[model samples]
Target: MVYDLAIIGGGPSGITAGIYAARQKMKTVLIAKSFGGQMAHKTVDIENYPGFDKISGLDLIEKFENQLKGKNVEILSEELHAIVKENDSFKISFEDGKFINATAVIIAAGAKPRKLDVEGESEFLGRGVSYCTTCDGPLYQGKDIVIAGGGNAGFESAIFMQNYANKVYILEYGPEARADEENQKRANENGKIELIVSADIKKIQGSAFMEKVVYADRVTGEEKEIKAQGVFVQIGYSPASHIVEHLADLNQRKEIIVNHDTMETRTPGLYAAGDITDGFLKQVVVAAADGAKASMSAYKYLQSKNG
Candidate 1:
């Protein structure tokens, strides 16, 4: 399909861009395998989003999606395989053998949650393991859940799960959690949240799903097993930039490097936003703002071409 703007992701950035482009009456298409990106997996309350003092990540993104209804933007549920510059326009190929031609492209694929490379992790994904607390937390409601990592995300997930689970255990491999002191204090004060520091997951044990978690102490080397119905992994995240790696300039961390003010990449017609771009705080509001900047820059680029 031929379009004025082709957005490569459906997360906050891509959707926000679609809202802007569609409102401007541009022929925009948003192709993504999934919407909401990393925030979908966070089954916690988001206290940072501007309007709502506290809301679920999924709930906020749902509102974002509702904003796009009836807009001129065409939403495609497909995974992007490759993107190539074709003359003055860009041609994007999807894994499903579909292609789109556009005058400008915005990449906002975002990042993937980091995984624990321990044994049995892959074998038990979805049986008793989960990365998204929002999607899987309700399944284990009123039961015990084990959460790995101690960052703000992890603590937030633990606090969110406390509403449903009998108890939430937070396993941090560091002496101190990476979360802000206030958040850590709140999580620690929650009677339902248990914090384990300087611990490393040794292995995930179960028959079909996760039944137990084996962890070792970093200092003493002592090992212990915690029986739980579910395990949520929130170690960190890696940028999702493989498809556009060869076409754009990427930083050492594999995120696309873009001009801070314009959100334009080294390539003239290409732009990047959100976690896939460097130098911005990774948050829903910032990502939405990035998308707006990228879309405006894309509009200018297209206008200059016609001029």
Candidate 2:
């Protein structure tokens, strides 16, 4: 069946698009590998999303999911292998060799956390290593933990982890922390959070659970290991833009390039939103707003094409 709009993602961005498209009477179907995407895995406190003064990340995702329960949008739990333009429409291919066609496509596949790729990193995933600061930080209460990365994510993670962990140490490979001034200021003055600059993460070692984190000094060439029960890897994030790499123009970070005002890519009838696009911020509210904009743009494009 050919759909008027097919959204690729199940996160807040994708769901928001689906809701808006349904309200507009657009025949839309959503393909999501994991419902709620990575947001489902987050467990930390979220106080920014409107309405609730404070809530867990998972809880916020659940609330978003509930909003689409009675919507007219068709939701599918499947993996998308690729998206190819076919004249006026786009064809979506699944791993099982099935194809779905759509007049307009909105890509909101979300982003995945970058891994350290160090030894024992994968083996000790649930045991110690974690990517979601909100999901696993509370579990390591009263324990010493380390965070790798000096960006905003790292600093924010350090600030969050400090609430539960006895001591939080940020291991940054650069000479200084690159996080925002606010997070940096908070982390710098916090008694429980220590910033380790000019450090290179070498390996993660443990038997059943992570026992230590190893890093080298950039100039001294001396390696150091810290005793810790948990490690949060916050180097950066990689958007799920591989499927549309050829269909759209991607920046150096593999984020889809789109018009800021409309969220439309260089390719006509194709739009992108959320963490997958190179926008100002990667927040839930912003992504949902993008979803709304993309759907409106898609609706306008359809109207113009038919007229």
Candidate 3:
């Protein structure tokens, strides 16, 4: 069946888009391989989002789901393979060879964590190297671990590791940590966490699991290795825009470029939102707002076409 709107992604932005589009009485369908995106995987408590003083990522996602209780949005749990514009409608193909058609499409697929391309990193993915601290922090209880970033994500992971890891070292490639003042201060004050700047990661070495990290001190030209049981790579993220890259314009970072006001991409009938888009802020609230705007913009676009 051809839907009026096909929303790809089940994150905050995609959920919000589905909610708004369904409310407008459009035949909407939200498709995703997984729901909630990175925001749902965050172990830190969310305080910046309006309304609740503090909430967990999973709890926040539950709330977003609650908003979709009565909306006429069909949820599809399928991995997207490709999206092709067929004349006037979009043909969305799934990995299983199933396909669907839609008049307008909203791409809110969000992003995935960036990986450290150092040696032994891939070999010890589950055994030691991890992208999500909350998921793997417990495995290193009473052990030493090195965090591969000094950004807000890196700082937050370091602070969280204080609860389980015996010693946490934050290695940053830059001259200083890039986290905000508050997070930076918290990480510094945490007795268990040590923030190391100008440290370039060179390799991860271990026999069965990760045992230590090798790096070079940029300032002193000294190669150093830190003994650790685990390594948390909290560098950052990369947009999941490969499925639609051919259909939209992307910036240097590979993030989809969209009109700020309408969330519309250069391709007509194709809108983008959330971390997948080149938005200045990568917050949950901003993504939700973008979703709302994209849906409304699509409604207007469809109206113009109908006229």
Best by TM-score: 3
Candidate-wise lDDT, in order: 0.87, 0.90, 0.92
Tell me the RMSD of model 1 versus the true structure: 1.9
Question: TM-score per candidate, in order?
Answer: 0.92, 0.88, 0.98
How many Å off is the CA of 279 in candidate 2? 0.8
Model 3 residue 115 lDDT score: 88
In model 3, where do residues sit more than 4 Å from their true spots?
A: none
Q: Using alpha carbons, what is the TM-score of model 3? A: 0.98
Candidate 2 deviant stretches above 4 angstroms: 50-55, 138-142, 181-190
Residue 188 in model 3: lDDT: 71
What would the per-residue lDDT of candidate 1 be over residues 265-295, giving only the tens digit for each residue? 8878899999999965998888999999999
The model with the greater lDDT, 2 or 3, is 3
lDDT of 2 by residue, 1-307 (tens): 8899999999989989988998998989999998887668764466778988988778888888899878888888999988999989999999999999999999999999999888889988999999987778899999999999988888888988888999998999889888979788888675999889999888888898999998899989999999999999999889999989988999999999999889999999999999999996888889999999999999999889889
For candidate 3, lDDT tens digit of each residue in 101-176?
Answer: 9999999999999988989999989988999988888888999999999999998888988989999999999998
Ranking by lDDT: 3, 2, 1
Instruction: Give the poorly placed runs of model 1, Cα more than 4 Å off.
Output: none
Candidate 3: clashing residue pairs, number? 0
> Of the pair 2 and 3, which is ahead by TM-score?
3
